[model samples]
Target: MFQGRRRPWAAVSLFATATCLLAACSNAPPPPVVSEPPPDAPSTTTSAPPEQPMPVEVVVGVDELEGGFNPHALADMSPTSSALADLMLPSVFRPAEDGSLQLDTTLMESAEVVPGTDDFTVRYDIQRQASWSDGAPIAAEDFVYLWEQLRSQPGVAEPAGYRLIEDVASRRGGKTVEVTFERPYPGWRTLFDNLLPAHLLRDAPRGWSTVLDDGYPASGGPFAIRQVDLDRGEIVLERNDRFWGEPARSDRLVLRAVDNARQVEALRSGDSHMALFGADAATMRSLEELGDTVDLINMPRPVTMELLLRPDSRGMSDPGVRGAVTAALDRNRLVEAGTGGRPAGQLPAHAQVLSPSEEAYRPTEPPGAIPPAPDPQRVERLLTEAGYERSAGAWLRDGRPLNLVIAAPFEHESYIAIAETAAEQLRAQGIQATVVTPTGDQLFGDMLAADPRSTGTGGAGSVDMAVAPRPAGGDPASMLASAYGCPGVSPGGETPFPYNAAGFCDRLLQPTIEAGLSGEVPFDKVSDEVESVLWRDAVAVPLYQQAQVLAVRKEVEGVRPGNGFAGPFSTAAQWLGTHADDDGY
Candidate 1:
């Protein structure tokens, strides 16, 4: 449902230009003094005094840091932001754990969509106490400005998630806000992104983007972005003394950047408080040796693998090749490889997507083990019958060679392996396949340029096969829409990933899935219906899903790791412990 969040570290130090008070008068810092009670004071070690609870500082791993920090301009949505969205901005109504829509009363007092119309035409109850970091009263127009800004981010992908809003009107009384839509859309409730400070941003010279991109001076969250120092590699967030809810307790929280290799060095040398995303297995194992020093958080997703069939793909447009290809692929092996150094799978006959939580997933290997037999012999047989046969030890057909070009993004390691596997499988079938590595930006650009309707890698030319992660939601509609929706797949043909690289266009599947997206019908039927179309059309193959693993330090408290997409802090801030909870020891 979302692109997996990956962050590249950049040097950001908030303390470089800080205004810290000098020791004594000038220079000569004050001496460290213990705050021990006077000698006459009674000792309370046996029956400890009720000490006030200290604020917990949570430092979790992020695969990639945020591309942009602004709520309005951020293009790549990260779970950190999704989690921070609660602290930073607020949604009118959010998706709940049970897969139902529920209201967030923090910003708007109340919200309800107009029945029968995709346009929510929602009515908002104002919270007068709500104020931005700059001390300006929160207003409905703040939301209005944010709406226009997000809609005008100057790129096609910018507004893809926000297409439901038709218009917004906040009246003069300053107590209400209304959103009207062009048609019936169920995702409308996701539109009311919590407003940024119109006061601080409105007058900035470089527009809002520059202010937040370079530095944030105003916000409604628990804290405002205080400073960024590139040299020390850190960003500091200071508690907002004016926050409406319980203020964040930490006076200053820092986000540092260190690679997985150096993370162990950072931990051993006492250079870091917590290791972030991109940590390798070796680093984690090393941290385990130190014990109670590092924390890990695991975020779960239903699945993160997708099929790459070109509906408009040439030659492959034939159902036989697609089906034969499906029958040829060893999905179990592919699934196991998707997760880093781990075996994972999603059986075709089952409803569960690779999980220990669901009783239906029976493991063939020991827990957390990838199997060795990927079964290539079975793949060879299927292609032989499809007229693509091995000739002179190479796949060839009708005096021509069976060839394919796969497009893969480097961000996800799985795509890299899948591309290689795809090449191998095609080779076994006597087909020659080439894998192309395109930068993230270039991959999408190439896909957008291709004529989506043309068969065989259709378009201006971009991809043959693309491996993408499809984050599953509680409902099948979430999974189905991402893989089979019309907007997802190009009508013109194969483009590139995130977009239906397969360019599958099933008129029936699209509308039915729409019904589910708009909450018209149950997604279970949508899933059944779409899979049937995929089954008949053989539009795309379903590879195995992915499971994310996070390692938490023992000392970290109230750290419950659940599905963030399901609910903000689903398990966050509840699991209380100190560096002593690293159960392994």
Candidate 2:
């Protein structure tokens, strides 16, 4: 039923075509017709045979399938495609429970950092037994080819660590690779994450961008693409027989693109085995509506929803005002209101550099030993001290009402609720604030711009505040390099300068951030120093860590909740198929 190539092997020639037309072949004895067993017949064998169970198929629901199958393509780096990449691609390194990078023994036998050089060098011993589904052996050349493409080619959004590699040589007759970096790249483990088969992609005609648009030619992971039907809004993946590791438990996997509103219905009607989406108000209602049909699993996300303020704005330019706003907000109440009154089990965030799930995270607080609670009196004192007076239930500075504009995403339903709640809190303290739901381009481009001249079509003069999610990868240094470093600093200079939307930049902290990113300084020391700056300046106010929620059917098994880059399908090889008679996972 699939409309694409089913397997890597060539089509088989079952019989000789020309000789079958001969008369001698036609005159050969006709095969006798097989007879069926009689209905009343007894057991013919000595004993009755045991019944065999059928192979299982799993259906996973997603928000949409808007991108291509090419994992290397920039457009396919969206959330849905990233989920699919976990099934078809093999990574040499994976994130451990403590948010640290660990080498995957299935792909690499060993990885060690070589010393005694000004530039950093790491040697990776590839597993000789690992091979792609197309039958090509996974070798050092795959890494070399991927590195070359990422460094020289276009379309890759973040090629930071890979660009620093001066050379990648194949030693031990192509079984090992020696990567010598031009600079110290502490996040080297995140590079070459999804290696492509060198034999298929090395000499690609359409280059890296469009080569795999039709579908992957081969896969190194547990599953391979069998069909991609855009019309039906589904992609079917089959177990890859050429996989060297443990084979997948399920026979087939179907990723369905369903709307957020219809996901609960799909699970209850037996159309989907699992679904993960934003825990918004509608999803909360749907979870209550679904009742006992599906189970909801909530986990901490490596993302944070924070209020990013523009220091160049009206009253927000003052550090006292920023501190007052931070003190006025009760993060515990905001967390409950944001997640529909705590059924989702979300946690309030205290630090921006690391999530509570991470081991290196520390609770950052302002100096002077103030209690961590809403202080209305302190808010009035700070406002009155900053050339403002409370008159007619409004704070007026220089004969003008102190008005603040908060921008949030128009598409994210949860963000809208958070913005509304924050606006109400600000207004309760005699500060006039308005929440505006703007497009992503307007929010990220115009409102979050470093220079006012580059504002987008939104025409927003000065954006006082915006609420958005910040991605924190396995390495915190790599994530916070631009935001926490100096005015013009990044990890290996991968991103542009002025990355922090809050416009909080300190020249003294640049060396510390750089040292942390390059592994020259201890992480604990860097974190302590960074926390002091964050708490003292009131750089950004963290609301809560976003929660990744999943709705799974009762019959499904081996559903491991994932954080950071890995999704639910990361451990597909160990997943068991769902059965109708099974009670629960």
Candidate 3:
């Protein structure tokens, strides 16, 4: 009976367990159900990244990239050289729009004429933060190097300014420059322009001529040379990250040397953003055909186009022959031809040492008052006086024909035009004249720089006369000395190469020129007399101020006409490319 009771209890326990399990199953939560996505549904896994903004670059078209880009050297004074200097070099003073000297606060803290000084002194305090692209401080050593080089180096620009400096005293770890001049220099503002890097160029292997020929050793301006592919006629400048002043608006400035036609085409096709070149009538017309696509302006360069008679050349050695050559050509006609009838061509430069654009320019008449018009009779008389006789419509002396070889730099378009026109005029007057276009170096450095006393007479590859630019400087006295001074002699009695372009030196007048430079005699007092001497000797015939046409595309911004003294390159740092994005898209 007890075993039967236990079996009944087990069955009841099993029934209770089944009831509890059913109650737990009824209270539990249900599993989630997922639906299928549509075939055309957009992605939900990830969103697209933001678009990146493009870098801004401006491409400029020019005539040629002929280098040897030492701005102070006469042989390297080309548009390319000047542009590169303006873009990459530093200056304590820069020309304002009104042609006044303005201190570049970016490079200097202060540059002033020291007060209470009997000796002319200029105190320059460089910005301590001003450092070259290579991380070297821009300091007094640069000034000392430039002063020493300009004072002693031959064929340098405006050496007289540096020659007057007695000493360059540096203080405050070279950040302060104290320049003591032998005498008062009113044109002190003109010194120390385009200051080069002393640490790189002081003992350069190739010297001054080749120091910055291909590319800059370091940059002190907003732009630094990135690449200089002379073979491809291109120079690329990129922003200098180390620049202490305002950064360049554009990332790169590419200068491409191309022909006029190609330049116009490039501008039209959006390949070039601007063009600065010596334009002719045909080139101007082609640029005009672009209509509203470009804004064109005439930029007067601080250079005077002049015909130089090499006094040391065979026939030119005779003053009478030089005068005859001058009498045969018409200055007005040459000006018209050289400028292609541009109204902005400065009035025929009347002074030899100063261009018409200069503030101190004064017109001095030639001695013995000759008419400005072409005088065939005067030409004939002068030639006859020089012991030449007319034989078969040609001037002949000692049974030899008077054949003159006129030279102009092959890279200069306006100079070539002037040379060709002058040659034609000479040929029309029964004078045998031919034009030779050699490189500027061959003409200026090799041929014209030859000392007449040593070279003797004409030889093969000799240039009788040349059509070249008379570089106009800030100091009139310095300009006078550079163009006409005698070869400078060192204290050791050694003469460096001559910088005189005329190859004519008068010992008597040199003292007067020096006096004017040394502030012993006033520049105004000696200018007329000095000019008279140059004119009487027939050293050079001034044509017109050299100028270039600047055509900027409509898309470019922050590019306006610059002062005649400084070309568009002066404000290159402010230029903006068309692709410049405000939103950094």
Candidate 4:
């Protein structure tokens, strides 16, 4: 539920930026002096103070680094970069274990929606004590600088909500920032999660995009970059002594890059302490044999595999036909066949657009929808009611065979298996259906190729259904809008995003999608409206959430992976090398 407007809140002052004593003091700096007790007055002291604790080193494994660490650019963004960014960059709010947003007091003091203000204004105050690794104060200008750099860049993909930001004004001597949006944006908290140092980026030679690489940056998080050896495929981070909040428990954290196949071996050989693994059923069973030496952790991914129905193609144009087809298929059977005996713990998806673990997850299908067993009789009845009749062992409508070709990409084994199972089931239900495995481009882009007579490559304007993955990240509404609600498929659009498979275009649902992205409406209400439209139209049949598994050594402590964004390292600062009570070295 969305709460109403609240009163303005105040924050306690943490630190003040002090000026150098005397304007001319910088010409010749003062000498360093130790604060030891005077020689004449030190006789009363007992024994010397205890020695400081040594830093703990944590070795983490990943598939590989994606070349850079800039959160704004796509080329530099990867799972490895994101894992490090969650620890190195400042965020106003963070996702809790249950998928709720909580304020990170280290970076931000207080953030609230300003009441009686139009166009959805949010006021944020930064913690005065926060400073970058280079000792520059973290101020409002950093937030403003990030917005200015990302507004028109080609490398920045997710810029819809940011484009709506009219201005970000600094106030109270750089302690606060007021962001004004052109329209209400509900997902504003998702913005400015990673702010770069304005002093470092303000005068870059080539620009911000080219300045960031996989190596290091002037970051302002709990940990700072210590070493980056791409040749050795390892990145090391040490605790930032300048950090103002509770100090990081582990003094040193190392991320080692390894191939997915070698992850388990690396863990077993003691090359890495904690490694990310895609443990299938057999792998998990084998890992269970390791006893108390290791522990396996599984988290649900935000990606969902679904069948995209193209209404522009034949047989699938009618909503009734699509509904009947959806009822005739079993999602669980598809998952079982597609996964090929791998125990990623895939669960059948019911909520249309939201993940099962998300707060807004709810069934969008009507009451008593989708019986336990797929009813072939019900499917036939629905098709008959929609002006289809059985003729010569195939369903026919308007003097043509109700034949459809499902275009499945062989990029992965699961896609082909799902398509084969679907084709077999549809044929049993009296529909003439077949599966055609094509290249990635023909399956997703140019399915309706210009040349209808070409063979062996192009879909030739004959594909009716496609099996693909839909992605959902920090904000699902933005991704859902681009996938479902649109100006139909753009024939001459940009590359990579050539077409919208479903070609679902509903003018009525557009406003709700915008409101959802704007945060003008509660997420539950927004999800309800958007999912209702998707289910009623049978736009796409969602099967299940993608599988994400990780293997951790029992010696690791306090690291947990959430299903969505910010993988296992989201809590890296709390990690320890051994149990709290352990005394053995």
Candidate 5:
């Protein structure tokens, strides 16, 4: 369950320096590379469809009713609002699963940071006739407002590119809006790239500098919020006739709030034309048995779930104790108990967001690297040699009993199972690792960067051991950036700018980190190499990468899932039945 209720979004974004570079220039920090387009979808700018087809209907699970259609706040990538957003408010650019940047062109001519010396200002040439749903001109200030909002809003966790840029200048003389940078970074493109509604939002938040709540304001995307049927737990999106981009083929999209019990029943009932996100394995299989076929979408990511240790802490200061704890546990048991995919090795499950061009990854692993299984018995032996011994049936060393308390998110049961089993294995090795569950903000809330012992083995903001799904789609650079390359605060004071969360800060990892951030190679290869190194260090155990399956009725032709973007399917762009042919499904 790699769900993102972690709500405050933290993305491994593009950064830049003060030098101004041309729009299409590949001069950013990472190597210049275009992400691979989704194999299943086509740009609407391609030749017109042989014959225009009818629309499609789709459904998905949403946490709450969307207050607004803006993706900046409303997290409703569910089928309904997304469909409507596409028609009401379309993004100027969208990324493929591989991190390639592309232009929507339907509403804008071109977009990029003003060229020359490589800086943060993003300038775009707008299409002459671009207008809002209310017929207001879509101007450069719209982009300016977005940058301003991101900077001033405290609750809005803006991604990387936005961090470096200081502000957006007026569109007075030039057709472009100049986005100023506060520092040097490589991720400028990720910002100012997503266009906003100038007319409606300009006056929004009390004169444009205000933080726009998650409310779906007047969208310039494909659709706007039609209704959130609270009684039925359903959300519906009708088309936005004023859409500037390719006209959405679909007129309406719907979403429901569903849990394990209703996932299969909802799809089997044919109540939804499409489903976005997948249910658990048992639920997925049951849907399949009901003659519901699902198209699997791959969202690779770099971040991962892990169990890290603060060796310098009171009892674990000895390497033997660390080894003892490591050796006592059976990784396979944890994976089988909860994780659905194969072993993650060292890479996080979600590293799929990085571009292959980053240097962190290698084209291929050498022979003997990336092995599927390792000897579990060897693990036990290693710990014994580390000086841990049985003391009254519990692992003890230096009279401390080798105790480690692991705090995991109570909501995620699978992770709990892993911790529980790990405790059992540690007991066998004469170590005590007590596992506890926490709900509310106390769980994984404040522990992440807090002092290890102060958090007393960590709590809230931190996870002693966590079982999380990697990014749905990304590259190794993305993974390294989040897990290994973080500037995170830790039990041992703050690490240097690039902190290795897993405590794997060998100077050796520096080269790989630079390589990944440099964007020097195709991401796929970069991922392979980076994964190898991370695995070797045991930064975090790579759990399995489960498939995100969506149940579609046989009658649903062209009901393909999206590879890029988020969620199971970014419904607004997909077509139902014969309509899929129009979108080249």
Candidate 6:
């Protein structure tokens, strides 16, 4: 028989007694007073009832809230989704101020690694009172559901940790959970961050994509979805009365979507209490004009900007050509051009898998003592070695000019600027290059994801290079695998994984990446080797990490900048409105 933590009967009894006393006090009138006042005495003046406090509501302005709300799915990995998840989901572990994982005791009684000889095991003791707003228990089934979907789904945020899970066992009427892993995963804490409700979503019609599309069926955190009005560009979150832990400080939270200028204007005009957006120089200056009424802070976003060279493209097929292209452009220049006077607080990305803001980030040196600065000599030498001769200031191979098409999403201004700058630099270095604007879906899904074996030299509608963003997460192993691993077959074995944007996979390095992800080897042991291989192949040139800005009025209390992954919404539960009394009514 499996022994699990028992509910506190003593505490329950005491709570019952207190509830009975409160009910009696309210429902039963005091025993009839034996002494009657003198008939002639004036009747005692009746005291007036106390005034009720007004509810507090905080309105926040943001860039947009137009993505699917599923936090685990790739298509929903936007700022809006992250913010919503932080406000409505339950997690066993949450990020601390130092970016370390800490057990959320309100949600779990205990969560720790269990002793196992053959396989790794983790035991979770959920709080007895922990339940969703809809009265569903937050238990082992939720963990199992998340693990199953993430490991099998096509476009998940990071499935490496979940893939290592062998089985999830339930006990104590589904309150206790035992998870057995195939290997010793160091990044286990990263799993099940935004656990979905298994009872509601286990058999949804559209599966993972439709999860939280309009509103949550139930909420496990301090706030619940009151309304999601896409047409009105607003999402209203009300305090979850069923929350077992501390209640939200504010009565309601309003997330209002608006443009950058409008976000600043709302904050200035006091229409919104706070605003978080990707601000340009003009917007930053506008916020600065608010003086002491507001405080502006830079918040790190979980994305890195990179110049991806598709190995299957015509100009990039040869390793030498790819190396030459990588050597010809300067990362600093690219960052400058991409930021374009915006106070993005971007740092030149040095590692392929981890962003500069990450705790485990270590700069990877370029191959063969290659300097960080652009080297024209190295570019010329590499191009010549690849059998390309300089003719009339342009490299040509077999009477064909070495022309390349660089693509960027038409909606992303920063990426477009970076692409144009790269084109100018390549043209200056005697390489024929042109910039093309394409929709993000077309650029990423169709152009960059083309398989070399079938495409056969990348015919029409193929881009030789792209300026895009690569998302980073808490788990380094998962980040490495998602960014560079070989294409995986779907659960049905018909569809292929389409997230590997590099289109460059080395057979020798695949084993090392797998070992790191599965915990057969330490991530530190394999990350350096994999990064070296990627640099040698010139898979991509990392430019900088993306960032956002948050401006909060002085009246709003308890709002702080969150970690790079979760943004400001991580502390949403603690946000108090301007009208909140000293008692936080």
Top-TM-score candidate index: 3
Candidate 5 structure lDDT: 0.49
RMSD of each: 11.0, 7.7, 16.3, 13.1, 18.9, 10.0
Q: Is candidate 1 or 6 superior in TM-score?
A: 6
RMSD (CA, Å), candidate 6 to true, equals 10.0
What's the TM-score of each model vs. the native? 0.66, 0.68, 0.83, 0.64, 0.62, 0.79
186-286 in candidate 6: lDDT tens per residue? 78888778888989888777656555677678899999888778888988788899999999999888899999888877888888999888788888888
Whole-model lDDT values for every prediction: 0.52, 0.70, 0.81, 0.69, 0.49, 0.79
**Candidate 1 local accuracy as lDDT?**
0.52
Question: How many residue pairs of model 4 clash at the backbone?
Answer: 5
Best-to-worst order by lDDT is: 3, 6, 2, 4, 1, 5
**lDDT leader:** 3
lDDT of 6: 0.79
Task: Point out the higher-scoring one by lDDT: 5 or 6.
Answer: 6
User: On residues 1-585, what C-alpha lDDT tens digit does candidate 4 reach at each position?
Assistant: 012254444322222212434434567756679787888874664898996555577788775655567766533444566677788888888886666777888788899989998667999999888898888888888988888765544334345556567889999788799999878776777778777888877887755556776444576887888777777887778778888877788877878877655776767866667876446666667667766777777766555678877665655778888877877787678877766555433556777666555555665777645555578888888899899998877888888877878877664567788998988878878887888886543444346322222343444447777776665465666556546644332124333222345556577887887777766776678778887767777778877766556778877788777534667777888888632222112
All candidates in order of TM-score, best leading: 3, 6, 2, 1, 4, 5
Give a tens-digit lDDT track for model 1, residues 148-237: 655443212234334345667776466577777545555555555556666667767875434555445566767565555445555555
**Model 3 stretches with alpha carbons more than 4 Å out:** 1-51, 115-118, 289-291, 312-314, 330-347, 360-362, 365-374, 398-405, 413-417, 420-424, 427-438, 456-463, 491-497, 519-522, 580-585
Winner by TM-score between candidate 5 and candidate 3: 3
